[model samples]
Target chain A: MISPSIFVFAPLASAALFTALMVVRSRNVIHAGYWLLPCLLAVAGLFGSLEAHFFVVVQILIYAGAILILILFALMLTRDVMDPKQRQTTKFAPLAVPLCIFVGLGGALMMARAPWPAIQAAAPGPAEQTKALGLGLIGDYALPFEVASLILLAALIGAICLAKAEKEPAAPEPVIDLRGEIELEESVSAGAADGH
Target chain B: MTANLTHYLALSAALFGIGLYGVLARRNAIAVLMGIELMLNAANINFLAFWRFLAPNSVEPQVYVLVVLTVAAAEAAVGLAVVLNVYRSFGTVNLDEIARLKG
Candidate 1:
């Protein structure tokens, strides 16, 4: 019997692959960045079809929402938009194409040939899976979780330091001619008194 | 035929290949970062697929995926910062032009 998920999986996978191709092939960097959005959404859909409920949300939230926005912001900051005239690829593209094909096909072949010990058991319910995930995160994976947080903090600091605009030292305050100002004020006052 | 482990594996492999091509062939630094993001996503898909098929009851794969995601986020942040800095100093983010180390 064909699983219902195949319907979802097929379209999502095709979308992912197609958009991924577009991401690499697009001459305009902004267009490529836009193409990445659908590709990421398709990947999230794939996660959903796989029944990874938590991951579907995470994938969409982090990969699609946060990461894609970050990438677009970087693209804008770098002013890499609208360069259709420039060659997007390097001179080594011909060599890279064949090498990538070999690597991809070789990986697929290996995965197909490998004997996977796939269990026949159904996946746990989403609620139970989420609960277990929470427990495992704070239990067995606590150390790694803490480490990941540390890495994030460090990255935040490093990014700020690296991207920050260098500030020129403050120029010395302009020397004010106090005497001229006072003399001008006195003359104005004297003229007023004379008028009075 | 329904989608299975082999199908997911094949898809990920294709994604990985595309990402690899992007990394190697793209002249722009930001594009290379995009390629890296694609590659990381490919790895995440593989991890989740294996977790679902091989050990659905275990949370190991999920935890690993979380770690990978965290690292990916960090990498992107730091990498984009480096790229921004490069653009500031060099006035171009083209990898070929910024190859000062190439003797």
Candidate 2:
């Protein structure tokens, strides 16, 4: 008899693959960003099937929620973001063909050759898994947990500083708006000629 | 047929390769970041599969997955922030065009 999980895994995996393709191939970047939603959700579903409950939640919350919003925000900030004529892929994309072939073949070969241990028929229950996870985080892995938090703190500060607009009396705008300056100069010259 | 360890490994490998193609081929910086995220997910899949098939009793893999998730979030945040900064100074997000340091 076919395992019941095939019903879920098959559909979820296919959807994820489809959305990932859309994310890469779509000319419209916003559409690609939107497509990322289903792909991420599908991955979460896969995590759930593996009985990684906490990861499934975090995947939905962080990947599907926060990261996606950040991407959309960045996309919106970009000028001509919705332009359909924008090229999504580089000319060097063809180079990926050979790389992919090599990688695929190598991965398949490795999977076939390696001897994986036999899997147990049952997954640990959610409560037992969560308890063990909590104890490990608080006990043996405490130092790493604290270090990870510090890294996150540093990342937060770095991101804020990088994205923040710099203020200085020497320059009103650090980034010289060249297009605006050119337009202003043209208008001023045109006015001078008209005055004469 | 059962959804065995080999099956998940195969799927993860496929996803990883696709993500690699995306990172190498895409011109948009954000799209490149998305590709990186995909690769990370594939790695996470591999971790979970190994945990389930090899050592279901240990919570080490789950903890590792959590750490990876946290790192992925921070990376995305910082990456997008850098992208925004680049956009501000360069006025474009096209990686090919943002070659100020090109020799």
Number of the top-ranking candidate, with lDDT as the measure: 1
lDDT (C-alpha) at residue B30 in model 2: 89
Q: Put down candidate 1 lDDT per residue, B5-78, tens digits, no spaces.
A: 88889889999999999999998888998999899999999999988887888999999999999999999999
Question: Tens digit of lDDT per residue, candidate 2, span B1-103?
Answer: 4576776787788788878877898888888888888888888988987787777788788878878888888999999999988887877888888889732
A106-178, model 1: which lDDT tens digit per residue? 8988888887755456788799999999999899989988999999999999999998987757999999999
TM-score of each: 0.89, 0.85
The candidate that achieves the highest TM-score relative to the unseen native structure: 1
Instruction: Work out candidate 2's RMSD over C-alphas.
Output: 10.8
- Deviating ranges (above 4 Å) for candidate 1: A1-4, A80-82, A117-119, A169-196, B101-103
For candidate 1, report its TM-score.
0.89
TM-score of 2: 0.85
